[model samples]
Target: MAYVGAATALGLFAPRAWAQEGAPAAAGAVDGDPKAFGPERHGLSAFGELQYPADFPHFDYVNPAAPKGGTFSQVPPNRSLNQSFTTFNTLNAYILKGDGAQGMDLVFDTLMARADDEPDALYGLIAKSVAVSGDGLAYRFRLRPEARFHDGSRLTADDVKWSLETLKARGHPLIAQSIHDLERVDIESEDVVTLRLSPKRTRDLPLTLAALPIFSKAYYSAKPFDASTLEPPLGSGPYKVGRFEQGRFIEFERVADYWAKDLAVNVGRSNFDRQRFEFFRDRDVGFEAFKARAYLFREEFTSRTWATGYDFPGVRENKVVRETLPDLTPSGGQGWFFNLRRKKFQDPKIREALNLAFDFEWMNRNLMFGAYKRTVSVFQGAPEMMAMGAAQGPELALLEPFRDKLPDSVFGEPPVPPVSDGSGQDRNLLRQAQRLLREAGYAPKDGRAVNAAGEPLTIEFLEFDPGLDPHVSKFIAGLKIIGVEASIRMVDAAQYQQRMNAFDYDVVSQRMSMSSTPGEGLRQVYSSESAAVQGSQNLSGIAYPAVDAMVEAILSAKSREELNVACRALDRVLRSLNFWVPAWYKDSHTLAYWDAFSHPAQKPRYTRGAPEFWWWDAEKADKAGVKA
Candidate 1:
């Protein structure tokens, strides 16, 4: 129930910088007096500030003075980096531009970009500013006349037209559907481009347009747009692709004549002089490389590592520092997702019963060593989390669509914890579960819950990583104590991805990055069509009429208040389904960095996602002892 203060209320309110008839605001000056200058008055500080990476939020941090030569390795044990084609579809044209990864930002620039920390605020990068018509049916973007592709061709309205049309032409149906209302594109002039949308108000238009990465019309036209070719991607961003040694390293060097370099949004950001991403198949190797100073920072897991791993000689010498930033964003939607496509698990009672069996307290203490906490809801620490804490009178109105099909118990109150802590089960909960099981046509035979078909009530746990063994093992043991025949299955990341794409598993242990915008994400996790995308999303296999309607209501929402209503309604349906047995989240992000670096005094206002605006401080990094 914490409220954002007035300062933060106006903090993100930046004027649209695009659609201006003149040269884009000289690189980086947004909040400034264009006339204010000179060493006598302001100590010769440039119009804007620049600082090292990790200075911004939501972006991958790049060290400001880090040499352009070293390979920066990241170990993600969950999925493969190499996928020729994506099975899932998205409406964001940017998602279709490159192989979707945290590192892809190196090669693309969106019309309006988000600072790493502030996910909601839009900053101009491609288009200088964008203005929407009063009726909300038209949007205009003015390109910077100075902007040019990596190949040196001037960026124009034609590129903007091509980017939008190309997305519709080549983007998956699901991706194209979001922009289906985009009726026409008009090149008003050399720099101004206008889009006329269908009369139906689309709230996601700005978000969709902000996500489209402008490609060089000349570059894409030289050859046909092919997803398979790695033909040195050209971009107009602050960084350009340097080297592409497949499965080895991807390097991006700072753009010397980057046109947008002086913008307020870009100043004191992207401080990293050179950025390199090293890919590793094994996490252990990545961590080892990090410990050896092969990488500037490494986020460590495994209590044994956090508590004892730092005892290395490097730690004694203070070669690295470990820091934790409590989870501000959702730690990701982690839970046992049920595949509703399967008939066996179609019963609401079954999903409810399965959720009730977990002893999160015991699992947190005994198995996790207090390293984890139970997930309260999706988007755990976000401002608009539609969780139990925030559901109220208006919120309840949104859930009425599914009131008839869902149990009062699901929406009535949150479940109570068992009586004993790891010692014994609560008789009352057990009795209630037994009643529900019997009501659902399960019979108790020889102390086992079995259906009339003589099938034991069993649930399979599908986990992808070997790293998850300890946690999944503990969960399986808990299910056994509850008299459910829970079994665990382990598969490699690739195989697990394949199975998930097919919805071939009964229950899955998975995670998802939640967006700050609730409506867009709510649809991704719960909509009916999402359930059908195979591996597109909706890993829980959810398909419901109420969810679909709520999603539409949410997207059509005009004001924040209306969006809250739609969001809360969708929250109730998801909570009632218990599709996710939420897991714990770090209060803040954990980051390790070398000591020989300095950044802007301001706290980051963006995401901790990698490749952050660290390169902004490149001009002054050497003074901070960063070696290039």
Candidate 2:
């Protein structure tokens, strides 16, 4: 799944920002300093030099001469319950109340666009160049002269400053949290904007600010910035909002004279002449629509369906192509996260007991058709960032200060999730779980585990997707074997979002996607400060000081080696906590598309280009009997 935008990260408007209070600036000054950095450059990388230098013609992942005059259609990609919108109520995706339309980010351009091949490098888009202060507290962006909004107005520094201020004040909670350290926005000229950050912020502050989607301030003069509305706002991007029905479908038409069309960063991207998203209430109906050619492309996520359900005429006649593309980035962490705020789950022994009862081997073999591997670390998909057998070297040194506060096991080897012996009932694992539960004050009473007060140890697993029933049922059955009263409570999408924002569920299945280059976003997920926030991503309610310190170490890392050590330390500590029952992840993406669409012989190392870099072939569609 794609990294969810700031707006969708926080489910609702709580109007809270992260506090900026920490150490002072290291050293250096503005003009009189000899150590100050040079003038603005073309790109920025997190910890190293950029791969593509300035004046480069195009990215290595794209086909520079790829044509762009055919329509591309597909169902909107679903990341999670809150991230994916079933029915869009507003075109303004920055706000909090409404379900924003998918692909709305395509209507606006950020100061910098992330390179697909690299981990955390960003190439300039609207901004021609950017420079950082010697003290690393300020970032200045020089906008391109030819940048223009859909309304034909030039994009200036004032608009960029206004966009930052507006999003900080009235946007979603996650957006507000991200830019909370914005001390000020100084406009040096009509086309140059300087953003000053607080001394407490991380090195990633400038990059995150550069990635903000810039909107037009003049267009919103007559409209309220915080209110949810369907009126399309003016933006300076490759595509503009076109035809749309309220909730069924939305189309974006490519701008024929898009200003950045010839830029090095956008040479072979946004190839589709028209991009459309067709809405369906469920994935089953959407798959049927794809088979009928209602949409030109579809990404299959179900293992059962991918293995057995592709025997239709489209595949038999070679009209549809199925391909499994490898994902190079970290899959992040997906698992059954416990609500630590709940008193019942506060005991570490109980949490560990719950983790031990999950039968991953049996489930993978029988239900998933041996299509998945057990996820061992929070950063399992990325080898460099993941903590392996044991904590040693720099990683061990980083965790030394907090040794007394962490588990002793963290110093030896990272804990892997309990493995089952292929049978659904693993008596050895179940016995161990029972022993842990008993030690944690849970005892067998009337065939159910009960505490001292005669209250049964019951857990409710909240779910938004009905398709997860079979998968969740297996885990529920395992818990029952250990004398726990576990039940599944499936709710609608809206209710699920409401419950999630309020942190009302005892446990929920969630997938937290991490970037190849980790940064301050880690704080939002595991920091103590975010634990009490209404809509923060600290779903596990994690509040350990050790975890917070490790997050700081990661954010303040100055080199690639430092960052790796910090990530390993953090992963080791989190695994020891046993806050989540680790789930399964597939390394490859299962995609099924009509033969009409064609892509470059080489794919991006970090992402599936889909309709963005892939183009339509008229001759191929004609031969495949597909109506484009």
Q: What are the RMSD figures for all models against the true structure? A: 8.8, 3.9
Task: List residue ranges in candidate 2 displaced over 4 A.
Answer: 1-37, 79-82
Q: How far out, in Å, is residue 615 in model 1? A: 5.8
Alpha-carbon RMSD, candidate 2: 3.9
lDDT by candidate, in order shown = 0.55, 0.79
Candidate 1 lDDT, tens digit per residue, 423-468? 3354555566677677777777876778888887887888644555
Q: Per-residue lDDT for 310 in model 2? A: 94
Cα lDDT for residue 568, candidate 2: 91
Using TM-score as the measure, the top candidate is 2
Query: TM-scores, in order shown?
Result: 0.79, 0.94
Quote the positional error of residue 546 for candidate 2 in Å: 0.3
What is the Å distance of residue 620 in model 2 from its true position? 0.8
Error of model 2, residue 128, in angstroms: 0.7
Report how far residue 599 has shifted in candidate 2, in Å.
Answer: 0.5
